[model samples]
Target: MNRKRCLILGASGGIGEAVVHRVIEDGYAAAVQYFTNEDKIRTIQQGIPEDQWAGSFQADLSTKEGLQAFFRVLPPEWDAVVFAGGHMYSGLFQDMKEEDMDALYYVHVKSLWMTARHVLPYMIQQKQGNIAVVSSIFGTEGASMEVAYSSVKGAQNTFVKGLAQELAPSHIRVNAVAPGLIQTKMNGHLTLEDLQALENDIPMGRAGTPEEVADAVGFLLSRSSRYVTGQILHVNGGWC
Candidate 1:
């Protein structure tokens, strides 16, 4: 008998890596995708046993050609997908470079929409599938210095809700995990003082962990969440 398989986009990242492990533990073979982090994805692939390793894919989602090639190579029968790819920019909206803005839109908005277009057919045919995107709290409560990031994440949230409604009739579920301040390398730019200040604002007095976020993704992919759809499950520790 064959087990279900899930594709983990941005599997090299902190939350993505945790989700990869979580999906495997939940009895699904896992395929990992990464853009430039070959070493990191390889390390994650190695950690999983061969039976649960569904191979790795490298795709630069910022380009159309890359997206085309990625879909061409993806295995045809993925049981679920977790869009955890992220790109961050922090600056005044006016000062934001066009290239940075383009990258954010491509990664957060365009690629996500395209991934759904590519996979929804298989899911619709099977009459069951799961999609969970890694969104941010800033998506709902806009951030001051991260206007572009917040805008794209807001688009992500909207996409989740809209697509969920459309796919519900097909028995496919779509949801998002909007994380607060997670302790990922993506936040390496923050100094200890910066982290402390941010933590102080959270009611929980701390940031969330990647594993905690992954657990939520796992539940969304599981039969446990059969009735849960079109929801943005906030993993923020009462920070919002």
Candidate 2:
């Protein structure tokens, strides 16, 4: 039998990379999506066994054209779609530029909706599918200095809930993994003092590892979560 096909967006990021490993281990033939990180894409490809590596796609998901171009090359029969593509912006709300907010909206919200819409027909035809987004803990309980990021992530959370309900009847599961504080490049800017202060607040007293979050994503995308849908699973180390 052919292996289940899984499309992993933003597969070059820390969490995305871990997710790739998890999906392969869970028996899915995986394809990856990246933006401009060809070097990282090559690195990710090297890690996966050739037989299980589906393909790699590059697209700027912050624009409709990019998404269209991406799907043009992406096959239509994916069993799962994991949206792990996005960036974080931190600064005072007042200091934010309109363009930055637009990019966030496009990347974190618009592209996801469009990607789902594009895949909906195929999933409905097959009558089974999985959609999981990598969201953030700040999305659940708002965070300061991350107003735009939080807003878009909150939108992502709501999108998952609404889309899950709509797709559940069709046997298409939609959910999100809301990770608390993963040690990824997104937080590479944090100083030692900043890191310590943040870690002190978490009940676990440490940041989550990308693999931990990937474990959650893998579950939601597998038969293990057959009865689950429209849920935001938090991997926050009991911080919230």
Candidate 3:
């Protein structure tokens, strides 16, 4: 049997990197997508066997034309699509600038919607596909000092829910993983004290690992989750 092709956006980030490992371990031909961080991308590529590595592309997903160009370079068929790319800006709502809002909208909301719009038609035509979106707990409950980030994530949560229903008839499954407080470069600015304080709040008493979150994603993409759709899986270590 031919191995399925899987596309992972933001493959250079912590969670994205973890997803790439999991996908490759599952025997899929994987493609990593990124807009920047060529060094990290190169490192990830080196870790995978050449036969399983489908190469990388740099595309700024903030524009429609950019997304079109990104997709134009790929093969017409993909068995799975993972929207793992996102951006977060934490600050007082009053301190938020227009550009901040635009950045959040472009990365967290618009890009996912537009990519899904472009990809789903092909999935529908093929009559089989899976889409897993990575969201944050803020998307469900909102977050202080993270107004723009929370809003975009909330939109992503709703998008997954609605898209799951809309695509189910075509034999396409859509789900999301909402992770909380993972130790990624994204949180490098936090002090040890800050990290511990956040961890204490979670019933699990520790920050979730990217690999743990990736495991949730793997489950959603597998046959075990064949009957599941329109659901948001929280990999937050018991945190709300």
Put the candidates in TM-score order, highest first: 1, 2, 3
Off by over 4 Å in 3: none
Stronger candidate by lDDT (1 vs 3): 1
Question: Which stretches in model 1 have alpha-carbon errors above 4 Å?
Answer: none
Estimate TM-scores for all models: 0.98, 0.97, 0.96
lDDT of all predictions, in order shown? 0.92, 0.92, 0.88
**Per-residue C-alpha lDDT of model 3 across residues 1-240, encoded as one tens digit per residue:** 578889999898999999999999998889988988999999999999888987787888766677778768766567898988877897799998987788789888888887777677778899999999999999998989998898899999999999899889998999999999997888888899999999999999999889998899999999999999999999998988
Against the true structure, what is every candidate's RMSD? 0.9, 1.0, 1.3
Instruction: State how far residue 33 of model 2 sits from its true place (Å).
Output: 0.5
Task: Name the weakest run of 10 consecutive residues (lDDT summed) in model 2.
Answer: 62-71
Backbone clashes in model 1, listed as residue pairs = none
| Selected candidate, larger TM-score, 1 vs 3 | 1
Q: Report the lDDT of model 1 for residue 83.
A: 95
